[model samples]
Target: MMKKYTIENNYIKLVTIDYGAAIHQLITKDKNGNDVNVVISFEDLESYKHNPTYLGASVGRFAGRINKDGYTINGKHYSVYTKNDVHLHGGKEGFSFKTWKMESISEGENPSIKFSYSSNDMEEGYPGNLQVSVTYTIVENQLSIVFDATTDQDTIVNLTNHNYYNLSGEGSILDHELLINAESILTKDSDAIPTGKYTSVANTYFDFREKREIGSTYEFKGIDDTYVLKENNPLATIYSKKTGIEMVVTSNQPGVVIYTPETMDENKISNKPLGKYPSICFETEKFSDGPNQKDFPSTLLKKGDIYKNETYLTFNIK
Candidate 1:
């Protein structure tokens, strides 16, 4: 069973559920004054229980992959759950797969909903009694997400929301135009884990410094890369020519992972399979494998210290 909490303003209507604290609906009007749900979601809670795609769920402990040999804290190496070698999005049973407690819900002005969860030490091979909270606040045409956490012991933390967005509310995102305030993207191995190196997007398909259709260069290859953000303005902007709706994304995090799965398997969890390139995820967070990379932004959380991150998704008509 799923419990839903909702908050809306004249410009948007947001509905989120306790299961995975997943966003069930985000109603916003297109340029033509037609309402559309801009995020991908399942109609039933059971689909979320078996969600193959993260959808609009909050991921945690560590937002991206951790190399084969996890990380060391105070010279003590710790092992984490891994697929073949990489430790992915926390683990098999990550935070997105669990139910969160409703901490509070407010329905005026800046309407919002807060959800909390506690992770036990060694759960999924992470070391810490972690307390996590996520707040979703909706205003006129913006949705702000605040992620906060604290641990009882030294641990690594990097949380991010995985929202698959389609500004037009339908069809392949390939038709959308995008702009990323990023000069380069992390170079990755075949497995999609950064190799601690970066490549400039100056003349490559990775470049999004100027607004362009997503299918212009990378076409069928799609993308699953982390971009090193430029100076502190909105990190990225995406627009749909069809609906004339635009989304400006800003975050305090240093990197943003953009992904579009290579294939869309409708047989995974739903009878209706989302076609290829259905949506794209803009995951803002610390650099991937941050705990292991000394040069990347640190993901360390000391005992008694607080961890906080915020991302703003503002909508507009263009």
Candidate 2:
């Protein structure tokens, strides 16, 4: 018996888990008053198990990269689990793949599902017995995600939900326009690890200071740049010139990694016309590669401290 929470408003609907994957689908009318499933989903556990890219899964333990999978914490060196010669998204078997304990915070009227998990000391090669909770709520046209955590020992923690979206609920989003309210970005090496340099978004393809078509320069390869946002405001807009719909992202996280399905090789559910580049992901969270880089923001959770973060995705039309 898998758990699913279905939420809707006048123009759209978002579905998530009584577990973790945020299978958000925008249910809207297509020219006619005909309702269609414009969103994508693996929906079942079997698909999520085989899809190494996480499909529409949440990212955690750590959401991005760590240098050499080795780093020092409080004058002591800790070697985290490795991937591509580095540590990516926690480690080998991070929390995203696990089933969280779920509880309904309210019985009716915009209810939310709370997911809690505990990571014991040195679990996945990191320190601390961290207890974390993430709540998902849908009210009006907004899908809000709230994350909280507490730990008994010092350890690095970064969490973010990875959901791909296409505002028009249409075909490839390569022509969709985007605007990021960021002034700078953390530079990275070819392997996508930060080079310890924070540079301006000026005159570079890194600039999304204004609306730009995702396809205009997409041939230069996909963007996974970590933008140093204006504030803890992790909001950006994607407007589908094809449909008049716009999707807005708001978060307390300091950075966002906007990515298209440039690396997608997964199957789309039949009856839907989805190409490889249909959707885009807005991964909102703390700076990437923090554990190894002293210059990056610290993600250490002190003993008895509360970690709280909020990210909301709202929808509307132009």
Candidate 3:
């Protein structure tokens, strides 16, 4: 039988994976601090094939774009294929788009669904035979994701999830209050690429030093940018000012990419309500090309090495 989990009691419609790292559910709420089912999804395997948005999908091989389709490492330039003039999330056939092998159990401390995959040498222009395992765990109102990866050759990798959250359990997150622990903002050149320079968030749209409404900031017009997370801290949070709901995002990674989904042309995804700024993603990962950038941390691994990345999302309503 396929592996799955349930927390059903007229509150949630929970589904797990015996295939990959995707959780399906409809989260509604009641007065007694309980969440109910409100999001519709396919009850069986057939419906998932067409589900785009990767909706709640586990992404990897690299979670963001690689500018100009390539980067250099150790004085060597490695070229990548251009998708729509730029390299997109793992070159179109990334892990998110694949059906992964899975394993499960019901009575563990924190029940989990593990998805494992391997990328051969030069897959997506990256070098290595990477063995990746993404495990999702839900415990005491918090969802913790642990990513374990090992590569036989040197390669670049970043992984994250694309989960749309509405603390109000409503449409759109424009009215949400977000606080990013950032002192200076990353200055980007054209094409939204980081310029390897920084600017103070003070007196600018990038400032989130205080708890401010996200939409209240004018620079939030659907532009996706990266922020080098403030050091000395392990987590950042966003709380809904109206519903009193809070989401804390914690990661061990060095940077976070805040993507206001409105940046994508709606038509590009077809006529669906899914294409707007209804959500924001705080993707935690290493700096893009950190291996090549003289100032950024090096992302290199030789054989017999182990690498790990972790992120946590905790939710509560006040």
Candidate 4:
């Protein structure tokens, strides 16, 4: 059965549902004291059930793409489900399609909710029985997401929330200012798989070291690149002059995928006719295709070991 949960603090409100452990809505106040939903969402549970765009879902067993042939661990190769020659977002029916169990909920100064799921052995061509949990917490103007998991056997894992943001609460994100604390990004092949190469962002269209309008770059094809994050505390920052809202992202992960799709299914969006470049997703997680790239950080999680990734999003008017 599908269930919804809501938790909020003085400065922000968060609503989530057990279906996919997805975020339904996140609301913050603008400079004019108006409520603004920075992320896109659907109108009903049916739309979420067929969430083709991923929307505000928590994605996993692996968050990014994997080569179609799959990866080898402990000298044994494991094949995964794929489409169009790419194993994406943890196969066809990944965590985003599952109904997670609500483990707990707390309401106080810092309200929070915890959801858990158990993946059976070999489900979706993955090895081992994995146990996972995602916790969402709100304190003041900040929201924190914590992902924890453990597997019975050695396996790969990369989890992240797929929340498309439009700080203005409507229209495209072309005018939003973005800044990424990274010097290089992973180069990809035609199939969107990392090519084991790091390209410098200096003087390039991918450069976001300085806060600048997303559309300032001419002929912007849209960003679907993974940035190798520096040791900076906040990995990225986004601001919208239209609403005077700023979002600061900080994560313990080593990489982040900034995705700005050229278009979306407007019919699925609630009370809005969103068009091209409507929102941007900051997927804070390990490098894409890390399992296939020898130089990239490993996504291997051994038995008896715990895998943890924590990311914080702080919002304010500036």
Indicate which candidate wins on lDDT: 4
- lDDT by residue for model 3 over 1-318, one digit each (tens)? 344454322323346554346656535353456553322233565444545555556676877666774887556678876665666567767776676676444434455556778778888788889998877666656666778889987677777765655555545567878888878756666655566787787887667788787778566666366677785254467876555667778888877777766633334322134423666767777665454466765566666687777887766665
User: Higher TM-score: candidate 1 or 2?
Assistant: 1
TM-scores vs. true structure, each candidate: 0.95, 0.89, 0.82, 0.97
What C-alpha lDDT does candidate 1 achieve relative to the native structure?
0.86
Clashing pairs in 4: none
The digit string of per-residue lDDT tens for model 1 on 80-122 reads 8888889999888999999999999988888999999999998
Q: What is the lDDT of residue 235 in candidate 3?
A: 47
> After superposition, which runs of candidate 3 have C-alpha atoms over 4 Å from their true positions?
1-20, 26-32, 36-53, 74-76, 217-219, 231-234, 263-276
- What lDDT does candidate 1 reach at residue 105? 94
Who is ahead in TM-score, 2 or 4?
A: 4
Lowest-lDDT window of 10 residues in candidate 4?
Answer: 267-276
Quick one: best TM-score, which candidate?
4
Model 2 lDDT tens row, 24-92: 454654444456554556645466655566656667788888877477788888887786787888788
Residue pairs with colliding backbones in model 1 are 266-273
- lDDT at 273, model 1: 41
Report every candidate's CA lDDT. 0.86, 0.72, 0.64, 0.90
